[model samples]
Target: MRLRVEFTTEPFDLDEAPAHAVVAREVIQSADLDAVDVGPFGNTAEGHADAVLAAVDALLRDSLGAGATRISLQVNVVAEGHK
Candidate 1:
């Protein structure tokens, strides 16, 4: 199965990206995933279940350790023929 993960690490920083946000982006960008989209307000990645899950695990751990006060996330199963 394939999975899509969408997330944001916060205490938003308008002047610069926070450490937690930077960590979160690093986790996703380096994971064994595809279709990654990292943005100021949110981020998203798509890949096989294992890859997505592993990325999620690291994203949570690293981002929180870097001091994110909150994380908003969602995961969904991609339909068979969908992106």
Candidate 2:
């Protein structure tokens, strides 16, 4: 199934936000999931959702450790057998 994961947070400056973006991409990659794209929105990331919940959990832990104030994530997955 295909999924889309979006992450938003505060304390992600333009310069430092890239670091967080990289972290997110790495998480998805580590999970053996395809990262369609990854970028920052003030302090948010919007793109492929290969690992869904697992990726989100890891992202939260990693991002928070990186000094993020607030982190919000949304995952949309395509159900099986639904084409």
TM-score of each: 0.96, 0.61
Where is model 1 more than 4 Å wrong at Cα? none
Candidate 2 structure quality by residue, lDDT tens digits, 5-46: 666666567765545556765675566344345556622223
lDDT against the true structure, per candidate, is 0.96, 0.59
Q: For residues 8-71, could you state the per-residue lDDT of candidate 1 as single tens digits?
A: 9999998999999999999999999999999999999999999999999999999999999999
lDDT of 1: 0.96
For each of the candidates, give the backbone clash count: 0, 0
Prediction RMSDs, each to the true structure: 0.8, 4.3
After superposition, which runs of candidate 2 have C-alpha atoms over 4 Å from their true positions?
A: 18-21, 42-50, 79-83
